[model samples]
Each structure stands twice: as C-alpha cells, then as structure tokens.
Target: MSRTSRTRLRLVGALTGALLAVVAADPAAQAHCDDPPTLADLAQRHGRYFGSATDNPELTDTAYTKILGSEFDMITPGNGMKWYATEPQQGVFDWTAGDAIVDLARAHHQKVRAHTLVWHSQLPGWLTGKEWTADALRAVLKKHIQTEVRHYRGKVYSWDVVNEAFNEDGTYRETVFYKTLGPGYIADALRWAHQADPKAKLYLNDYNIEAVGPKSDAYYGLAKELKAQGVPLDGVGLQAHLALQYGYPTTLEDNLRRFARLGLDTALTEVDVRMLLPATEEKLAQQADWYRDMTEACLAVRRCVGITIWDHNVG
Candidate 1:
C-alpha cells in the first residue's frame, strides 16, 4: 500500500476506536466520563487541546462548573469577547465579563481562546447606528481590534480574528467592514491582531466549510493569498454546527487536510449536532458518532491543532 493509503487506514482505525470507546463507557460515569478517556485526554494523546464555548451566566452553576473544568483544557467565551460586549460604547471598553471567564479558566488551569475581534453581528449601537467614511470606519475597527486583542494578549491561546466573512457561495459577505474597507479588512484585522498579541494564533472562522465545496474553496484561496502577502493568518476555524437532517459532511477530513497543507492550523471551533424536535435514541447515537468522527478527523491531521464544542449544554 502507498503511504497515503496507510494513513487513511490509520485514521479509520482511530475513528473506530473512538466509537467503540464511547459505546463501552460506563453509564454511571456518564456525567464526567470518568471511565472512558475524556475528549481532552484523547486530544492530548495526539498533542492537541480540546475546548468548549461558555458564557458568564452559566459560570454560576456548580454542576456546570464541575463538568467544564474537568472535561476541557481550553475555553472560548461565547459572547463576552465579541465586539459589542467588549466595546459597548465607542472609545470606551469593558473587560468585566470577558475577564471573569478568563479568571475562571486560569483557576482551572485552562487556556482561553478569546473569540471574535471582528464580526458583522452583535455590533454596538454607538458604531452601527451612524454612518462614516471608509477612513473613519477603518480607524474604529483598528482601535477595536488592538484594544481587545491587547487586553487578552498573553492570556489567550488564539483569536477568531474574523468570523464568518464569506457567504455559502464563496462570496465575501457585504458587512459594514467589507463595504467600507473592501476585502482588505480581513488582512487588516489579522495584522492588527498580530500587532496586539504577537504570540496568539489568529484564525478566520466560518460555518458550512467542513466540506469541500464553494465555501471551503473560498477559504482555501484566501488563506493562500494571505500567506503569500505575509499576513499573520495562522489558522482556519471550521464551525461544524451540523444537523442530523443534513447528514454529515463526508469530506470533512479531506477539507481539514487541504487547509493544513497551506501551513495553517485547523480546528473545529464550534461543533454541535442538532436534530429536529423530540430527538430519539437513534438521533442521539448519530450525534455521538458525529462527535467521534470529528475528533478522529482532527487527530488524524498533523496541523489540526484542536477541537472546541460550540457550548457545553447544547443538546
């Protein structure tokens, strides 16, 4: 067999092992999975980290806290680090909520993946309610990226510098930044983020790119272009927010491998397998299989660094 075939077989075997391990898990240790290898343990065995998205309000629940601390070694703030949450008013910043989550991560010896320096959604009224020239908006965006990224500079493991910047058809979404600054906004956001936190890995995150299609192709082209220009683009985050009805992205592992070939680290940034109402046991088992498959895919790739479930409590 060729080297490629051997690697493929190894990946398949790893996936099968993961599934069997899940199937054999003791029911009594289901909450924390004390008997089976936790996701973090499995990831660590492959020199990767496992993480989950979380919010401040959920931090107050003891049960939630215990599971989060025990099951994962990294945390992504679901909202507290977004543009609106970090900078509620222009020229003013608030780190209260984001800091709280960071504190929690530190206490648990978990690294934080500070999410989202620039996104079209969750914009504060101060910036969105007004109109401005391209130059003015550029300044605002730079300051926001610099301030937020600098604040969490050393504390974060990575930053989703630009989130969902592309449409499903492989076109750039005409968000305020894109309209004002053109596609250059992506490169600029990445540069500013690197300036602020030189050590933190920067990523462009999006959904529906788990498969080899137009959307994933767009990211591939952009990543190559960014690398050519010496941009500090470090990774691509595939938000695998899948649904059972849609079936699995069969090309997920291949997609990740292609991105890794660009000398970029790949991660499942936000993963959840949702189903229609009244989810049956069959659906639940399917979801579990997907979880195992995703984990296996990440472990299979050398440049695939980690996996982060969207949030802890999603069904």
Candidate 2:
C-alpha cells in the first residue's frame, strides 16, 4: 500500500484503539524501540535531543507520556495543529488543537516546535484569491504570521518560518507565495516571524535536501544569502524522509557539515523509513541500517540539534 493508504489505516486503528492503552511503561522497549539501537538511547547518547509527532486524543496517555517523558525532549503535533486545523476561516482563528499540543509539550517540559507559519500548502480557501495583488497578499501574509506567532510567543522553541520555497533544480518553485511576493517573500516571512516572536528561533524547512546536490546546494546558498542579508533565520531544517528500499544518502554528513559551516543550527525533521509494500528480511535490515546512518550523522554534527520522525509507524 502507498503511504497515504497506510496513514489512513493507522488513523483508523488509532481512533479505534484510543481507549486501549499499552500497559508497558518501559520507554526504552516500546514498539518503535524494539530494535537494539532504540531512538531513545540514541538520542540520550548523542544529545539530550529526541522528539516525535503525535495526534492521539489522549494527549496524556500512559504510553505516550512514558515515551515522551523518558525519550523526547521536543514534541511536534504532526498535522493536527496547522493552518487548516487552527484557522479554517479568514479572520476567525481557532486555537483548540494547537493550544492542546502546546499545553502537552509544556506539561512534559518538552520543547515545542511549531511548524509552517507560512507555506503554499494547507492554506485555507479564503486566502487563495488569484485576484489579490502582491501588496494585498503581503498584508494577508503578515497578519497570518504575526497573529499566530505572537499567540505562541515564548512557547514555541522554533518555527518553520518558510517551507519548501525552492525546487529540486535550484530555482524557486512557482508557489502562490512566490508568484505574488516574489523570492523576497521568504526573507519577508522570516522578518515578520522574528518581529512576532523575537525570542523564538526561526527555521527554513525543506525536503530532499539531505544530500549535497542541486537541491541541497540551492537551500544552502539561500540560507547563506539570508544570513548575509541579516534575515532572522535561526536554523535550517532538513526533512529527512528516507527510504528502506533503494538506499538513503550516505553523504548526509557532508550535507549537515555544509549547513553548519553557514553558522546555523540544523535539525533532522520529518524522518521516516518507509517500506509499505511487501518487505523482505534484507529490506528490513536495510531499513535498520538507514536509521542507524541517519542517527549517526545527526549525532556527529555538533550543530545538529534534533531528529524527529514524521509519523512513528508508516503502516
């Protein structure tokens, strides 16, 4: 099955099993940690930096609380708390889901990472006007960032101020944000986010930039330029979505090193080793090796702060 289908099945299972709490409190030997090199142990050994994405209704469940308490120092609410879930209407902002996530993180003394203050994806219909000129669109964007960031001020440890602005070939994707506000929109978004919460660390997040290639070079160059231009970008987030089949990039260390040379903190966000279709024993072993390499790479980098998987279980 595809990842989407797998995700749907998991969601259904989660909803049904919401009441069935896992009795085991052994955070070091949980389902995802059954392997020898548990993510919990790896994180504790590397840095005190470990995190996970969760959206269960029982935010304070035994299993979750146990794992989070022992293993995770940071927590991201996956997609349960983003623009669409928080603000479905134009000016009517709802803080139900996101606020719950913040509260849970705070309760556990975990650092909260707020994703995607500005992105072309998951935008509400009200903000999708084709007629709005650049100036008008700028006004809307500013309000969106300011309102949301200010509300979560002092709460969020880092915010993905801008996400996936560049294509795989070192060029800006023709996103609505780009079309209306031009490439400057990224810098503008960072500035706006900084103004909203000066203390919050702002990051630029993108996928497929884990290796030193055209896409990686594009992100690195942009980050260097942003730093030079005095943009308030605090970190660079590498969304490490790896596969267990073909092979993950072995050049991840070089990639992280290059980003670190730019004097910015790095994070391995949204990591997962997918093997949804049939899997052989060799494939599973390869998957384990993939996870090991990623962990080792992140651990090696002094500037690499944390590594978070997108979803704990793909299928």
Candidate 3:
C-alpha cells in the first residue's frame, strides 16, 4: 500500500461532537506547587523536548494547550487513543478525542506522538475471542493501522508501532500480537504503518529496558536485528517507568549509548520516577535532578532524540 493510497483511504472528522465538561480544580484541592515549570519552558532551557500524556478525553480545558505554549514540543494522549479505547468493538471506530489531541497540537504548532498502535494490554474483548486465527487477526491489525495512521497522515510525528514484546529471558512475551501473528508481527506492523504514513516516524516502545541487563539486551539485540533486516522501524521508545524503591539503573548511560549505537533514534517515552507514597518536597526536587540528568544523557548521545516526562506535576 503506497502512502498516497493509504492517505486517500483515511477519514477525518470534527472532534467537537464528543464535547466533555470542563475540569475544575476542587477549591479544597491542594495546589501541588506554587509554580511548576511548563514543559516547553523546560525543553527550551535543557535544549530538549518535554511533554506528557494527559488523561483527558474531551480535551476541552486549556491544560494541553498551556503546556504546548510553555515550550513542550510534543503531546501523547496515552491510552485515550489506544486500540481498545479508540475502537473497542470490531469495525466501530471512534476518533473524537484523538482528533482533538492532534488538532490541539497542530494549533499550538507542536508535534503529536501517537501513544501506541499495538499492545497486549487494553485490547477489546471482541478481538480476544476464542475463534481468533492468524489470518483473521492479520487482516484486523492491518486495517486498524492503515485507518488510524492514514487518518492522522502527516500530523503524528511518530507511532509506537509495537510495544513491550520481550520478556526477561530474551524470549518473546506470550501476548496476543505475538501468539496470533507470531514473531513476524513486529515487522508486519512497522511495514503497514510505514505504508500508511511514510514520512511519520515509527518506534518500538517498552518498559524495563533502561538497564544494561537481560531485558535491555534483548531489546537492543532485537532492534539491531530489525534494522539489519531492513525493517521500516524508525526509532526506539524507552518507557523509563522508574521506581524509587528499587533505585534507578546504575548503567543507564551505558544502556542508552548501546541502543544509540544501533543507529536508531530513541526517546524517553513514559518518564516518571515514582515512590511508594506521596512525594515529599525533597523527593520532588531530587526527581527533577534525576530528570535533568536523564535529559543530559539524551543530549550526550547523537541518536537519543529527546526526553518526555510522563507527567509534569511531579510534586
């Protein structure tokens, strides 16, 4: 499928139809911070991009736009645009909220990175039925990618075409995508999405791949193999779902450098350093420093694209 044909097969619609109520901060809701740095502002100072995935459907408020104005160059709507969320039932597609996110990004002159195209989680109940076969599943996957990517066309900067596909042992996870479509699923997804929007970047995103261990090695090796085989994969997404309890990776820089050496672009997809309980003032500032260091690491590597904070309200 040529990109031109795929673009022509797409459908665009007005997002104003699914209007949502404006969110109001509770009068008693504690202000997290007296003044927090806007994503754009942080990006400009650090010489990198900063952004987040908002949990809003209507997008009627000024939050996303405000972040864009502050220096954030990207916006990902998270699960709001996932497979199940967008088209829960077979053949019934909805693009109201997704369209709003892209439109808002365009209005702000910011880039929009689509959260994901395929994943084991958040799959609709219908797609996971008993009679699901490889052929039937392949058709569904291709159609979904073509439709979604074509709808956005040149709007989306990149798509996480395949998320979390490997386990700790360097073997493929038993996800429906892998189980139904086999290991070729990843390559097939990239090809389809690339055919849909050739100019847009495509990435493979996953968590727990930030360390220089079995998991990270598996991902690094897989990415190298894919690129070597001429896969249309354009980039890699490091979810960076960090935890304070286990402590951060000691060889974080080494892991990132290894991936960058694979000759593919990389981005910090879901960056949030979380503790068990509410964050303290000290923890917030410490987390910010960690974030600064993470951005510094990205800047150090030529292939490290940018850093995207999953959320701005660290406090």
Candidate 4:
C-alpha cells in the first residue's frame, strides 16, 4: 500500500515547458540542479520552501533521488515518524526510519517537516492493543509526544502535532486518543510539542480542508480557541489531496487567508491532484491546471509558508 499509493508528479504547469525555475537570489549562491530551476528555488524567492514526502526505501533510486534532493527544499517522512514506526513497543522507541529521511534532507540542504506525532492510523499494536483509563492514556500520550519531539528537536522545522482530528462534518473522529482523552487531547498535544521544542512550529495537518467547509471551519474554531487559551498552536496544514473527479476547492485562497488571519501559518501539505486510471491527455491537462491553481493560490498568500508535493512516482 505504501508504494502503490504513490503521489505521482503533478508539475506546476505543462510538464514539458519550463519545468519550473530555481536560480538563487544572487545567482552566485551556486546551483543545486544542473539545469532546471526547481520548485524550491522558485518558492525561495517568495520566502517559502517547496518540498516532498519521501520514504527510506526510495532514497536508493538515483532517478528519484535527483528530484527528491533538488526539486524541493522541505522533506516529510510519509510514515517514518508515525506512531507505529516511532514506537513499536509500549516503552521502547525507534528512530532508524525517521532519522534516515531527516539525514537525507539535511544532506540535500532541505528542512524537515516531521509528518506527525498524534494520529489515528498506523499505530503500533502495543498502543492500540489494550484499553486504558483516561489518566493512564494521557500519561502515555504525553510521554510519546515529548519523547519523539525532543529526539528530533532542533532538527525539524515543524511537527504535525495532531493530525486529522476532525471529520468531514466538523466533528471529532473517534480515535483511541479521542475516545480516552477526549477533544482536549488535541490542545494538550500541541502544548506538549511546544514544550519539547520551543523553536519548532507545531501544526494540525489534515486532508480535504483546503476549502471553506465544515472540516476547515472546525480547525479555524479550534485554532482560535487554542490561541485564546494561549496554547502553542502555530500553524494549520491543508493537505490539499484533491481529485479531478471531485473538482478543485474553489474557496481555497479564502480558506488560507482565514487561517492566516488567526495569526497561524498555513501550508499546502501533501498536495497531489489525482485522477482515475487510463488518464487521457485532456484529463492530464486539466490535472496540470489544478496543480497550477494550487501553486498560485499558495504563492498569493503571505502566511501560506510553503507547499509540499506528496512525492513523485516513476514506477
């Protein structure tokens, strides 16, 4: 599933034309890529960083590595830092996968956006295997969040403190954390992450929140509340995982603006314009249009810090 669920390349415009530019501000800073100016170069001009989500296995492929190293300036470990990968046992922890990707990013002169700290999916059996009282669960949660964030401190740019907390209808998802710790767990997670790494930005990342809708509304309300309480919430990640069949989020720009209004950074994280199989040229053109529109929307907003393509697939 990890390999097949690949987020294939969706370039800025036509795949053939410019392929996007990446010249340094001084043109004397030295070129990272031999020719094409990467999306990272283009985004840097606007004080932003473009990046992608990569896995440990793919680093060996030179073809993919070329783009992974040059096309973007940020790297997201798609699953490396998740609960399962980070903590396979009740008290034990692992950093092999997470460290590999972060090392790759640093080698390429890129910043790291740690994929997530608290999430409902891909949890290790030791965590999801048993039931727990509220207090016990809270302790476990805090320990896990602080442990991981602390380990990656000063290395990562941000952490997806809590991911996909709200559902499509603006209601909370009934995950283990929500079931045991309640909605306040989200706030607690953010605060704990901040304590672990005061310099790192903390974000709530989710898909399908790119537009003005119930899901985004839930985030906006929660972000406002967190700020009023002086919680350490710093950003909102709109995962912008759009499909051609569902149509683009027409209110995307306004949605970004609203988050920025609340004094929080916004990013088009996990961007991928997907379509059904046997895609025609016409469909690909429209797909490119979707990519272009999303890119322009992020660039138009000041607080929309950067964009991260989910990663490219050549297989």
- Please provide, for model 4 over 5-120, each residue's C-alpha lDDT reduced to its tens digit, 9 standing for 90 to 100: 45555554442222242233346534554666666776776688888888888889999998788777899998899989999998899999999998898899899999899989
Residue 40 CA displacement from its true place in model 2, Å: 5.1
State which candidate has the highest TM-score.
4
**Ten-residue stretch with the least lDDT total in model 4:** 15-24
The residue-by-residue lDDT of candidate 1 on 90-125, one tens digit each, is 889999999999999999999988888889998999
TM-score of each: 0.89, 0.84, 0.82, 0.92
- Candidate 3 error regions (>4 Å): 1-47, 63-65
RMSD of each: 7.8, 7.2, 11.8, 3.2
Clash number for candidate 2: 0
What's the residue-level lDDT of 138 in candidate 3? Answer: 94
Compared with the true structure, model 2 gives a TM-score of: 0.84
Model 4 misplaced regions, further than 4 Å? 1-35
Give candidate 2 misplaced runs (Cα > 4 Å): 1-45, 56-65, 313-315
Task: Pick out the ten consecutive residues of candidate 1 with the lowest summed lDDT.
Answer: 1-10
How well is each residue in 180-230 modelled by candidate 2, as lDDT tens digits? 789999999999999999999899998888888998899888899999999
lDDT of each: 0.83, 0.73, 0.71, 0.85
**Angstrom error at residue 98, model 2:** 0.6
Which pairs in model 3 have colliding backbones? Answer: 40-70, 40-71, 40-72, 41-70
Better of 2 and 4 by TM-score: 4
